[model samples]
Target: MKHSICSFVICLLVCTGSLASAQQANPKYDKKLADSLKADAYGMKMYYLVILKTGANTTENKTTTDSLFKGHMQNIGQLAKQGKLVVAGPMKKNDKNYRGIFILNSASMEEAAALLNTDPAIRHKLLDVEIYGWYGSAALPMYLPYHEKVEKNQ
Candidate 1:
């Protein structure tokens, strides 16, 4: 009898918990806004993912590499400012040929390649790039603003 009562109480709690959560509205939920942004559906779209790999000259020259990397950062900022790049970051502590990645706003591989070529690191052959078309949330473009809010030191 005691076990039966405990099981009943547990089931009641679980069902009520699920019901309460289902009734709660997400803070950012707005149907009109979503429709206005053309994200009413699954909000999936094609984007280019550029993978940066260790180049032939990646670590061959430290001084030149430092300068090229500085220019690379500048290029990243420029692309972000132009809304051409959705996200970019370097991989940490990896021994493989992997270096970094860029999620580009472009749908065309040619365009992505052209934009990537603008980087001094790429231009000077300090980094090699491979691009692929990816389908993901159209809401991804909205992430950067919210990301800036919680970022401490940029």
Candidate 2:
């Protein structure tokens, strides 16, 4: 009876130790797997052209536009530092045209729109900004192969 009790206690300790070790091992592998899965799902980054329509001919409106443009330029630098704004620049040669382009990572179109809607430039309405979804070779890894096929066919 004494020998049997001793053996049982030793077996229980061994099993508990193995289970603890297994739990620890699983977290390491699980983290690696989770990271890989996330990369696969959200690897593609998206871009947008923000068209800021300038209001016509009111002194107050023009002044507001000027002030907003200056503030937006400053905010843009901060956004870039935070990894929110990928690239941006004012539109050239036209008073009413896309003011800037923003490239960002988002899970969906809604998410991208939401991010744009939060921009101070959009909120102030000094410029009417439209966010247009951009799909191209630069953003998608699969684009080149598809383009090559089209070119070959042509």
lDDT of 1: 0.84
On lDDT, the candidate that comes out on top is 1
For residues 1-154, could you state the per-residue lDDT of candidate 1 as single tens digits? 9999999999999999999887766677777766644463555677899889987774547888888999999999899888789989999858777889999988589999999989999988888888999888777878877767998985
lDDT of 2 by residue, 1-154 (tens): 9999999999999999999776543323444544533333333334554556653433456667677667777776666555455555566766455555566444466776676666656667655666677643233332334544676542
- Per-residue error for 146 in candidate 2, Å, reads 30
TM-score of 2: 0.47
TM-scores for every predicted model: 0.71, 0.47
Q: Note the residue pairs that clash in candidate 1.
A: none
The most accurate candidate by TM-score is 1
Error of 2 at 41 (Å): 9.4
